[model samples]
Every structure is written in structure tokens, then in C-alpha cells.
Target: MTKTFKTLDDFLGTHFIYTYDNGWEYEWYAKNDHTVDYRIHGGMVAGRWVKDQEANIVMLTEGIYKVAWTEPTGTDVALDFLPNENKVNGTIFFPKWVQDHPEITVTFQNDHIDLMEASREKYATYPKLVVPEFAHITYTGDAGQNNEDVIAEAPYKGLPDDIRNGQYFDQNYHRINK
Candidate 1:
């Protein structure tokens, strides 16, 4: 069946399998394993414990775009990576379909991922790629196929309960807003 994801949350929840970003977990342990400067494995952004990377502390997943090594310290490093010289040349990725369809654009930023589908909002087919770090989730099967099933199969089955209550993806697996 063709998928219809209205938001990024819906997309990630249904299509992408996500974990705690093991690299970040190692980093968190390295920084706080046995020291006074101990912090949790996940970093806090906007009061949420989002995943991180080696030099970055945020990993956001949208429909077709995924980003790692994002800095969360209010620094301009992320800005430096953005396109300043050319609007048409600043994007990090241009899937083969997007390249042929110039009007469609999906921009992945530190906080959110935005997809502008030109005039084909409902019909655009998003990329079906999964980040290696988070590939345990499965979106298939019959009656038992729910969020719980996906989470249980995840590498880290014990994610904080609060994380599930807020603006999480839906069964359809897409997020519409931040």
C-alpha cells in the first residue's frame, strides 16, 4: 500500500527504525562514566532528550533527510554549514527524484526538517531510507503491529516513558509539525 505521511513524526514512527544513537551513548558514558561532570547519554534540547553524534548532540529524522553531528551549544557551526552564497546550491541532499523535480525541496536543520513539495503535496513519494544507528523498528504485520511492538524490538527497549507521550509520530508514521 502507498504511504501517506502528513508530518515528519508520522514518517519516522512508521517507516524509520530508531535507537538511542549508540555512539552518543558511548560519548555520554565517556563524559560521565565516573566523573564529576556527568550527564545523561542523550542531550537536552527544548527540554527533550534527543540523540546526538560525536561532535554534535542532535539527530533529527524527517521523511527523506537525516542529519547527524549537529551542535546544540548555541554555536554558529551549524550556520556555517548552511548555504550562504546560493539558494539553489545550499541543500545537503538532492535525491534523484528531487534533482529531476527542481520545485521540490527538503531541508534538514538542527531543530526540524522541512519539505516543500511545490504543488504536489499529497502525491510526492518520499525516500525510504533508514539510518544505520536506528534500524530495529519494523512497520508491518497484522493486529499486533503497534508502537509498542516497534519499541520492544528496538535496541534500547527502555526509553523514557515521557518521550512517548509528546509530539511523537503516528501509526501512519509521519510528523506534520514541530
Candidate 2:
């Protein structure tokens, strides 16, 4: 038997750390306002609305939910959520890029998220391949800290200079207070 959540409300008030594929990181929060806020550390030090739309949560199976939304760029994204395991699986579709290499699967776990590019011979020319193969996003502290501090303490801190500065997406992000 598996547990099921009645609504997206179950995820409200939760905080998470999101790490992009390019090593950029941000703190994420699901607010009561139905908006997802992001605390960026690069150029902006403030929390802003990265997603304001209401997420469409559909129960796919027992203990499994499908959350989806459309981006401002008209791209539709969806994630399969397994609340019991605190995990999410999703594929990011890049409509404007090479059609064959449009989708990349990402796995988000309790402590980390895998952001490696999907294996495909068609993506052989992708620039990110030059960097370390396995990229992961790990949880850190709160936002508002200096970028230097974040980078210094990241798991990738010991990576080669070229790989660190390369197109790798490995990063550490902070989680906001609930």
C-alpha cells in the first residue's frame, strides 16, 4: 500500500535548494500565495518569484504525483513526484535546441539532485560534455550569503579549474526556512 496526497497544498510551506546545470544555485520556497520564490546569489541577493503559476498536480499512481506547468517561454515541463521517498523525476525539454537533444532527465532526491545530461549520441556535440560527467545539486544553508562562500564550500570545490568553470551543472544551494 502507498500513501497519497490530496492536493498540492501538501507541498506548501516547504523549502528546497535548486541547483542549475551550470553550477548556479538558488534557494526555493513554496509559499501560500501559490508562488515559488527563488533566492539567487549571483547578481541578485533578494528572493524573487521564479514561478507564479499554480502547479497542476495529478495523481499518477499510489504515492506518485505528476506536477506540471508551462514556462514563460511556452515550454511545458513536468515532474513525477514520489513524496514518500522525497524524490522527483523530470525531463527538461529545450524546444529551441537540437530536436534530437531536446530533453534531459533529472532526478531530485532528499539531499541531492542529479543534473547530468541524458546519454545520447546526438548530444555528442553538446558543450557540457567537456566537463565532468556526473553533476549533482546538493543542499546547503539559507540564502543571502556571498557567492564566494557558497563556492568555497561546495562539493565541487576540489574539481579541476577547467571543469569547475566549465558547463558542468554541479552546485550547492540553500533551503529557506519553513
The number of clashing residue pairs in each candidate reads 13, 1
Local distance difference test, each candidate: 0.24, 0.37
Error of 2 at 141 (Å): 11
Worst lDDT run of 10 residues, candidate 2, spans 105-114
lDDT of 2 at 80: 63
Off-target runs (Cα >4 Å) in candidate 2 are 1-8, 18-28, 32-35, 38-49, 59-63, 97-178
lDDT of 2 by residue, 65-163 (tens): 565665432335565655556455554443332233322322121122122222332244333211111113243222232222222222223222322
* C-alpha TM-scores of all predictions: 0.20, 0.38
Best by lDDT: 2
